[model samples]
Target chain A: MDILVFALCLAIGIAAGYRNWLPPYLTSRSSWGLTAAVYLLLFLIGCELGSYRSVLEQMSGLGVQAAALCLGGLLGSALLCRIVGGGGGV
Target chain B: MFDPKPILVLLAGVILGAMGHLPEGFDDLIGPLLRGALILLFLAIGFDMGKEPRLWETLRSLSGRALMMPVAALLGSVAGGILTGITVGLPVGLAASASAGCGYYSITMILLKEAAGIEAATIGFVANLAREVLTILAMPLFVRYFGKAGALGAAGATAMDTALPFIIRSAGKEVAVHAFVSGVILSLIIPLSVPLIYRLLS
Candidate 1:
């Protein structure tokens, strides 16, 4: 559902841009706008994390398991990149 | 390409939030505000992509390598998750399901709840949440050392949203589109994979 909404917004934005529906000024300053939006997005993510106090407690209690899984996934990804990443690094 | 500025903002937010300083009614605002900001961000990304005259040409050239990255990531995540689960004494099947969430907490948690029950769902939540936090903190370094694919792999399903900006900043605009495509594919696959894995395990 979230992905669908985001995709819909992206498609609408592209169409709007292509057809000149959005004002030129807004389009011109979009890079800055995008950056600001990113800031807000991360802030909200942090807030969500903070609100979930039980999650934090769980994290602390199960720190080793969580860290192990996270690191293992990342390591697996890196290893896979070595095997399947045909093109050189960007 | 990586900037310290945005990360500082993220850290500040975390600090303030941890300190219990979010304003009254702020909790209510988070969901809508996040969705709204996401729309605006995607709109900006789409507009930017549309304006690039050579975008199609680049995507064509990059598609093969780009397409392979996410498949690799998914495989790696499952392997890693199962490995962790075994080390931690969790059933391998349950661990694989949790890892299948691939850093997409909400979708993974809900799916695990329905398919594997609340315990698996909780593990999924923690594991996927850990992935997101790790991606946010380490993406630039991943790009710097391991290249664009590593960053995308770490981002999992979040390459489309919370991690998109950092991916762009770290890997550049060229990789950003690939990240979006990879993220989309992973997001689509996750909904099915979580349940399928659970069922298979059961």
Candidate 2:
């Protein structure tokens, strides 16, 4: 459901943009809007995280497992993309 | 941390939250507000993408090859999951589900809680959050060491938004297109993949 919303909203925005339907005021400030939204999101995320006191309290116990998987996933993808991705100038 | 401003804002929020500074009813509103913010963020990003002079042309040039980045992300994340399962002594499905969250912590946690339980959900939350934070912190280094595709792959589903600025800063604008496409693809895959893999394997 959330995925559908994400794709739908983005598609709507894209279509509106293609059609020049966005107001001039919005188009001019879109970058700032994007950045502000991201910061707002980060703040919300932090609030969400900090509110989960149980998670924070139990972090020590969960830390090792989470870290291992996180590092492994990140490194594995890094290597794999290097091997298979041709960098695609990505 | 080339860009510490966002991180600082995040820390401020965390501090306040930890202090129980939220007004009454605010906690309940977080989820809905988060969704609203995400929608706005996506629309903004999509607008920029569409506004590009040669949007379709750029995407067309990327073509099928762009799809490979998501595949790489999946394979790599699975490999990580397997190792986590072994080392952490978690069930195969549980570990895979958590690791496969692809930096999408919120939905992944909710889904895992329903499907697997709070323990799996916790792991999913931590693991996915770690992916995003790690991507943000390591992006510059990844671009320097792993090149553009590696950076994009490391970002998983976050490359579209949270991790994009870093990619754009470290890599050029050209790579940003692939990053956004890869992010969108991975984002689509994660919700389906996380629970399905759990149900199938567990």
Candidate 3:
């Protein structure tokens, strides 16, 4: 369901973009628009995270696990990218 | 380009939420509002992608290989989390779930809370939150050391939003689009993988 929403939304944007459907002013402001949308999304996510009292309550105790997992996730991906040579050069 | 505004705003939201003073129905409004924001973000992404002349050409040439980055992200995080769990004497299942959060703190924590318990959920929440912060902080370093794709891997599902500013600045617009694709794939995988991993571990 979430995947469908993501794909559908992307498709709509692509189609609109391909046809030049949006107003010139809006298209010109796309960068800021995108940035604003992302900020709104992150803020909402923060709100949701804060609403979870249990998670908040126990946050301090989980520090080690949090550090370990973050390091692990980053390190693992770094290692894999190194081996796979995933750089396509944008 | 490497603006501090997004992270600051996110922190402000968390503080406001912690205060627990949102008016009635504001909580209810969050669901639809978040979805709307996400759609708008994706639309902008797609539009930028569509405007690119090389979009289709790049996709066609790299169709199969392009997928490896996301796959590597999934595999690396899972393995790394499990190893961390064993080393730290934490339960393997809980560690995996926390790792699976993949920088998506809210959803992952909620799901783990429902499926596992408070401890697991807390770990998921903090770990994923740390992942996002670390990604933002370490992005330039990742780009320098591991290149664009590696930075996206560290970003996990956040390539679409929270980590995007750094991604765009460091890697350029084209890599930002690829990061979005990678992010979307990982986002889709997280929901399924969390439960599957939970069930398997139990």
Candidate 4:
């Protein structure tokens, strides 16, 4: 059931995007329709995270791991950029 | 420069969750909401991409530089995983999460639940979430110091959405397309890389 709902939402979003409806929302800065939709989605993500706060606290010990991942990702990305000769010139 | 919508939504979710008073069917709301949000985000990304001037010219220029972003991201993910594994004295899933981009939160949480249980899943969730936030915040700086290619790498998984607009605005169309393509590719690789690294290390 949840999967179905997700699929439906995804399909709708993609369809709307493929049709180029989202652009007008931003260009016009219209508040009533698509802007509301975008805002709603952002809010939902925030809510999801907030709902999981207890889990977040319990897992607080993973902070070091998080920091390491951030640094490692940055460094690794840099090296890759250099090796590939892609990022150096940009 | 933080957008207030996400903050408000997060607060709303927390409050609703705390109340613990949702009706019987209320549980069904989450899936649709999240899916809808993701679609909106993606669509916004595509729409913005379509509007960039001289989009092809920028893309043509980025062909060389864009190739390096994923490699850099992969390296970062591995480094992160190893550090976490050593510190935690357990096979931390940092590699996958870092490599996968922000998508790690959803995929890692699922994988952690099945492989390591609830505790590990929670850690993966938080770690991935932090990575997403960091990517968003660091994108402008990376673009400034390292240019479009660097910004693409720094954006990690969010290059297609959160960072795409800024990248397009700053570096022009080619860099934006490069960042988007690179981000999508890296995001796809995250799931495979996370478990692969964990297995290799453990």
Superposing all C-alpha atoms, what RMSD in Å does each candidate have to the true structure? Answer: 7.5, 5.5, 6.3, 7.0
Segments of candidate 3 deviating more than 4 angstroms = A1-59, A87-90, B1-62
lDDT of 3 by residue, B59-167 (tens): 5666565567777777787778888877766788877777776787765665565467556766776788888888888888888888877787888888877888888
Q: In Å, what is the interface RMSD of model 3? A: 5.3
Q: Number of clashing residue pairs in every model?
A: 0, 0, 0, 12
After superposing candidate 4 on the true structure, give the runs of residues whose Cα lies further than 4 Å from its correct spot. A1-59, A86-90, B1-68, B84-99, B102-104
Task: Estimate the overall C-alpha local distance difference test score of candidate 4.
Answer: 0.53
Local distance difference test, each candidate = 0.70, 0.76, 0.72, 0.53
| DockQ for all models | 0.37, 0.45, 0.39, 0.28
Q: What TM-score does model 3 score on chain A?
A: 0.72
DockQ for model 2? 0.45
| Candidate scoring better on DockQ of 1 and 4 | 1
lDDT of 1 by residue, B1-202 (tens): 2245654665576578778898999877866676566567667766766665465465566657677877888888889888877898777777787787788776565556445544565567668777887888887788776777777777888888888998888788877777877787686567567767766765
Fnat score for model 3: 0.54
Q: Rank the candidates by TM-score, best first.
A: 2, 3, 1, 4
Per-residue C-alpha lDDT of model 4 across residues A1-22, encoded as one tens digit per residue: 1333334443554455445565
Cα deviation at B146, candidate 2, in Å, is 8.3
Candidate 1 has a TM-score of 0.59
State which candidate has the highest DockQ.
2
Per-candidate TM vs. native?
Answer: 0.59, 0.66, 0.62, 0.55
